[model samples]
Target chain A: MITKSIMIVGVGGQGTLLTSRILGGIMQEAGYDVKLSEVHGMAQRGGSVVTFVRYGEMVAEPIVEEGQADVLIAFERLEALRYAHFLKKDGVLIVNDWRIDPITVVTGAAEYPENIIDELGRKHKVYAIDAMKEALALGNSKTFNVIVLGAAAKHMDFAKEDWLKVIEKTVPSKTVEINQKAFLVGYES
Target chain B: MAEKKIMLGNEAIARGAYEAGVKVSAAYPGTPSTEISESIVKYDEVYAEWSPNEKVAMEVAIGASISGVRAMASMKHVGVNVASDPLYTASYTGVGRGLVLVAADDPGLYSSQNEQDTRCVARAAQVPVLEPSDSQEAKDFMKFAFEMSEKYDTPVIVRTTTRLSHSQGMVVLEERQEVPDKPYERNIGKFVMMPGMAKGRHVYVEKRMEAMSEDGGGFFVNRAEYRDTSIGFITSGIPYQYVREVFPEASVLKLGMVNPLPRKMIEEFASKVDKLYIFEELEPVIEEQVKSWGIEAAGKEIFTRQGEYSANMLRRILLSEEVTEAQAAQVPARPPILCPGCPHRSVFSVLKKLKIHAAGDIGCYTLGAVAPLSVIDTTICMGASISSLHGMEMAKGKEYVKNWVAVIGDSTFMHTGVNSLMNTVYNQGTGTVIIVDNSTTGMTGHQDHAATGKTLKGKTVPAISIYHFCKAIGIEHVVEVDAFDLPLLEKVIQEETERDEVSVIITKAPCVLLKGNHFPDVCVPVPEKCKKCGACLKPGCPALTKKEDGSIAIDATMCNGCGLCMQLCPFDAIAKEPK
Candidate 1:
């Protein structure tokens, strides 16, 4: 089997790293070698955070070079645009259709960019979803990361059973039913 | 059947470490990472304690690890910076038992002074780095890191980001391993990092890394994906999955152990793909390494070197040239700031109003540097404020320094401010040091400190007061004033500054979020007797605002009234009405 790289990006407190954990569980349960790394900058003051996960046989480095990401799962739209260079030519880009403006952009020190998809059109196959909205529909507005994860899982080779099992293993039993349902919605959507 | 629990990423790390039979855990409390030790505290087996600072915490962990019991040390990214001196040597000295140091990074200045990357430290130490994306991974990685530590006889770093540390997810519980009670036979040369001993340890570290690369192949931590391989991605942590999400058909390589990376596995994967993209966060450590290996790759450049990434970020870089204006318009921005009714606000408010050039210290009180309050002038380290104020006083005569008060939090004062306080008294510097005692370490979710009179385990400890502490330090004028009493506080501050010798004002107030406290003062609006002189605006209270008619109105809903603005107003227009 070949190795594949994935990148997850979002603002701090948006569960970016939890998405990494869920994926890590799925990959581990699927019996694949996995290495996950995350970088958090100024996370306390509501800054952005990113997580990098590599899986498959014989994965070497912890980071993916520009234009080589097999998949890019973003919790925020603008964040998706921010790290687009990591996507390969045919890379799959699944982004939550949400934008969390940075402090500079919000305070008008910098102009908020207009279109994320247009900028990403040159090198990736982008699919945007209102994952946060779907998560809110699942009863918790914060579960947007899970919803996005579910959508990303749909195109992955890891079996649905393995994913579900890993999800069960990763999450508590109390919220298992809902998270599973959320995952299904994300997958089947 | 065992029950699974939904836990935060930090809790999972704690549980993971516990399951791995971690015997000793130490950390200095900081956001995005504080909960690791706190969660470990709930377990019966682990000896967990919040050390005085990150440096002490690292030393304690090192001492524990040397005892042959699996030990763990954790801190935020900056905390790791403080502990770097020990961390660098610890890697060379190696570990007797498993040692896992967790560096929880804060990207985007979430709660940090700057966005310094921790990956560089991982490489600098030449230790294996494990990055976990989610809660379960955080837990599993914790166990894997410990196992790797033992196998390699070196400390392993489990690097977690803010999202991974604070966000909650489901985690299946498992039986924990029993920890060995006895210490390992000590070899002074191996444990000690003196020049001669360190050289031998370094050679051993290199040998371990070689064995790990050879014997560690096909391990569960490294995996490969074969798909449409026109381009393949190599990434770790949470970003690995995002790469897969964005490029479903591309082959990908995911590496869990980042440092001393599994080179054999990476080379095999690189041969299949026509082009490679390295996906990681902050700096291009991996990308630079790949290039050094003579493998041309791309990452961080097209993807931007700063901030976090998402599918949209990847798509924008690789798919589209730019984002539509409308798409950008749809994004929402929420930035964290000092929570409303923060106790430190009043102290900074008085300082800013009095035009005092204050040297600020760490803690939640550091938010005083932000706009609207803009009270703090300089923030160097945890307890630098007091010493800085002393220097400023000595540098720029006492008269100029009188208007400059050093502001520090209660937890900070307990940490290192006491020495500076004694120095001020010893040298007879007539500087006014204002202790914003919020009754807790407010920056890190109100953790208990010595001043809080509570230990980590909820037991009562001796409570020390800045008031009495200053008095004992030979400051004859030690005054404890209500920080919310703005008028009285201003007068007291002025009086303290004019004093010939060293003095202090303990602006004491419980944090608004503190339980079981009644601070009934609410902002009262006066529409008639008001002149819009903007005196109340000078304090920049969030509750007070100018109405459309140019009269200052108070949003009772938003105000605790604290009556701070009332004191600033000369017209007696704003008064606290009985709630």
Candidate 2:
């Protein structure tokens, strides 16, 4: 089993924390060792958050080193750029085309750089999608993270079926149908 | 088939507690750990409440635990500092019923006052610590924590790092169980922890640790994989996955029970590999333990000792050849800041412009210490603002500084700010405190609190007024100011700073998100009278964007229409559109 490091980056409230859990569930069920670490408590006010997901036969660290992530899943445009440098040269990044400037940018002390896709593309393979729009189209703006997760799977050895099982096992029975369909849309998109 | 639910780690702990027959739940909403009790209250079976602070919450849980049913309490890491008085004693006294204390550690200082790991607390209390890697484990371990609590007759700690608590995963929900209700069991010798009883309980705790390690170690919680011979890795918590990601063929010992670590498992694993590296985040708790057992491990040497450990860090530490130049850039050199339209921005701006040294407390308000605002001088945990301000003023004298306001959030004020206020009154120092009450915690996903008059489940609870609290604290003057009202806020702050005695100015505004999805109030462009002197830009509201003609324009799309810019506009170039 090849060691694969997945980094989930986004503004708080974008459900970045769930990525590690959902992804870990799939990895753990696949009989692979999974080690994940995330920022908790506080960073919840739409602050920037990053979660590190690593899985294989022998994991060592909880976080992905800068620029060492094999896959970068971003829920917001600015966060994609903020963490863009963490992607390895041969890595893949799936970004949602939404911008929520951080406090520094808001106070006019700094500005978000232009053309995040172009910048990320310079170092690694980049896919920019309006995941939030797709999620909104599906009637839940909150599921954008899961949509990005689906798009992210296309680049990895992570089995689509296994991810579905985890989702089925984890999602509430009341919203299972919607979330299952949501995951399918994300996977197929 | 058991029902499955999509739940966050925070929710899973509540689910775990409910299934474990938890009779009572209490906590103060701190990030990462807030949702545990919030979700517990959703189930009609358990009694849950939000205490004023973590110390109170801990005492309340202890009181419930003594009654012989299951009980649980949770708080963010630093919160444990407040509850330590009871936590240390409770470990010696042990528990009458199952008690699970969940302390969510925020590595990377995400939303906390500091990233003090709670694993240390577990070790210090001489209790068992279960660190769950995911939501499923979070749920399972919570129930297990309670079980271990009762079996060992001790308070068990389910230690969750921020990632494990806030992260959402698929949790297989269990049916809620009912706890046996009975009268309190009064065993003074065991519960009181008197010097005589304490010595006996202390020895019992040591014996319990030995039994738990021997029995629980062989339990599935701590397991080993014999994959390859050359290199062996010992790790636990979230880093276990990262180590596996890099060296797929390496032998590994992944520890689920972090505290009272499996000594037998470690020695066996160490003997198998030619070299060993203990991979863990924050501090070297596991590394130190292995070393104490006469094992030389490599960690915090090749890998970073600060912030958080990432997969990239693991690869570099274990497989150095795999790293590349582009990967170097991916590591964030700087930390994240607050977001635009943040409720804390205006208060910081006022403090910055006045050039007054402010003692800032934790919460979203701590961002005021960052660039542009840079108004805050010190940030020392929660409730330190008011007390620190009093100390600074008394030592420096009131006449020395122009502005010296203690900036604190509404939730933080209630958490420990009450005591700070009382100290300010007793000390009789002339200082001003700005309570930035955004109507929610605002820093930690806007969790409800005592001041909000709402429960986490959105039920109405009694609200505590900062104004009334200030008056009760013996402040001669107490007033409220709209934080977005720049001129009025500035005048009020300026006057309060000059006051001869204690004063408090409450900044009242509902966070834009909590305002119920109405389009944020926007500033209308007065295109005709625009000279664009750039005076409005001084306050640096993101809603105001400069145009090509040097005329300032407000993005009706982005503005919340607070109109502080209107007051700052020298040429009357800005105004708020009618609601």
Candidate 3:
């Protein structure tokens, strides 16, 4: 009935932009007034990054405010923990269960928290999956974001056929089949 | 229904330039503004080129305007400071044709050194500024700015914030408005800026400001929307969107023309509302003006003058609602790091090993200040690395900088480092400048510069050799070394810094992220040979991590086979394998 805001949070270089592009393409094709806000600069160098996607009859603000996100998709466990607060009280959180040590962890200054999924699952509705394992099963680790996006698709307001059509047009020609397969693996999970 | 598409604000700005019949566009690649030229090049009609820096870009646009054609230059806010020399003059001289300068301001410091508002600069130069709220407006305002420029005979600045530039929104496509080229008439009194002519032009500039300010009240870009009179917001650009989101029914005077703010419209709106509030990010450009008119407005007292503002801010401030925010989970911080196998990592690794302090410049090399590779002592701006080092040497003499060197990227070296290099040579200063020649602008996503031998329009030109540029500038000692060859690089850095005269050491390596860059091998960890001593992890390459088994593991996917980790490993625990 109102504008739906989706927040995509992930570590930079983890194909966060690809998933945002796919979502943007789908939203526009669906004839919704969509706006996506992204950060482009020095921050993309493996820092925690976010892309806000909002669509509805009329979208006003580009950024999804704290506690206003209807859905939040994360590509890394730490990033999910970082931005999970942006989700609404009953918002759905689909997260990839993966770990990449930050410089702090490498330097022994901080510890990567344990039981992040369990902690978040107790608060917000959480769907945690090891997307890296799924992508590795597909023989290409880079398609992990497509798998995560597929898992989150069931929560969004789009049909399977619409997703398939957009995916075909969005991805590169050579990787279309693999991305399709990757999306289905998460869709059926 | 009209055909519409979603694009970046930068892209929309480019489309606006194309549709308005712009003939020439020049820019220097900086974040949030780089994509403008990237998109502008797709149109075959416009002759777009990426100049060496922003000053050159501003001059190019001024020259093009004087040649009787609509022209523009785009850059991040700091670049405007470099180009302000010509910008201030262009304001006085006016334009032969409509000229627009698109300055993208980074209010949140997303990718910039400072969060300076371009509107502040506009007020100083006495130029008018038009700010758009969304993608469609980004296009519409560009066209309007040209018309406004030619009508007023003054250069127009179309300013956009990071939120406006990087955001993507739906925009209705439009046909090109093919404006006829203006005839260039010989008017020395108007074009020339000598003392006598400049004095007359100064009066003309003041008159233009007065006229623009009066017209600004009724300008199409400025609008007054009425709903609730109890509270009102006078906002512009992206902040206007927040007012809509937070208080949909509140009366608003959305000032699209930020500079030369509509005084009459603002006063009238203030009279209608019971209480008025001014909302602007970065600097209080709007609030200060509205307040100076003896009108009361509540703004920075409750709102921050730093970073981006949002709907939630207005909700908590104006509405006085107790909004419960979800508690953010505590987690390890993930700061931006150098990409695995980045050539800067290799060079920085050697610098860290030599225990040398570096006067760092911008680019991916700035990340060297982060973790285990923390060798950079300071990072001021683009070319401040060399100049600051010269300052340090001049301040403390040559003996103080015995263990110091200036590290800069190739693109930054071209930007302003060359000028600093000449200053060092002319002033008889002895300092070492390491030109980290990664062959592209690494930080801003690898846009080709002069040394890259490529143009913004994808044309292949004779690449300017950095080595020759250094030698031709009368620098006596200059050398080129492979970035990945750790031993040789270390030796070269040591020899150069020890020298008496000014020297340039060019480290040659292509950025790992560049397209068509292929690695013949991948680095793998030999678990059995691992001593678990952690020497290889000192460089802080993201690919090397400590496994629970007390051994280092290599992420084969991210490694570029640069062998920096292997070179660092005392036990030869890491091996390069064929992919």
Best by DockQ: 3
Candidate 1 chain B, poorest ten consecutive residues by summed lDDT = B323-332
- Candidates ranked, most accurate by lDDT first: 3, 2, 1
Q: Which of 1 and 3 is ahead in lDDT?
A: 3
lDDT of 3: 0.91
**Candidate 3 on B366-482: residue-level lDDT in tens?**
888877888999988879999999999999999888799999999999999989999999898899999999899988988999999999999999999999999998997999999
Tens-digit lDDT string for candidate 2 (A98-148): 766555654455666677778777766888877777877888776777888
Poorly placed runs, candidate 1 (over 4 Å): A1-189, B1-4, B184-186, B321-325, B329-340, B390-400, B418-430, B467-477, B498-502, B571-579
Model 3 DockQ class = high
Q: How many steric overlaps are in each model, in order? A: 132, 39, 0
**Model 2, range B444-516, lDDT digits (tens) per residue?**
5667788889875568868988898888767879989987777788889999888887888999877766658
Please list the C-alpha lDDT of all candidates, in the order they appear.
0.77, 0.77, 0.91
Q: How far out, in Å, is residue B115 in model 3?
A: 1.2
**Top lDDT model:** 3
Report how closely model 1 matches the true complex, as a DockQ value.
0.10
Residue lDDT tens for model 1, B1-579: 666565678889999999999999988888779889889999988888877678778889888888878999999998898798899888888887899999988764556776777888888877788888667788998999988888788888899877567654556788899767446786889876788988888888788777777755566877788899899998877677567656888898988777777888888889989989998878887788787888878887776667766665777778784533223233434444454365677777777778877789987776677666778889988788989988977898888887788888888888778888888888888888888888887767667877788877777878876677777767899889887787788899989988878888888888775676546776575667788777776545545656557677675534665676776677888877665
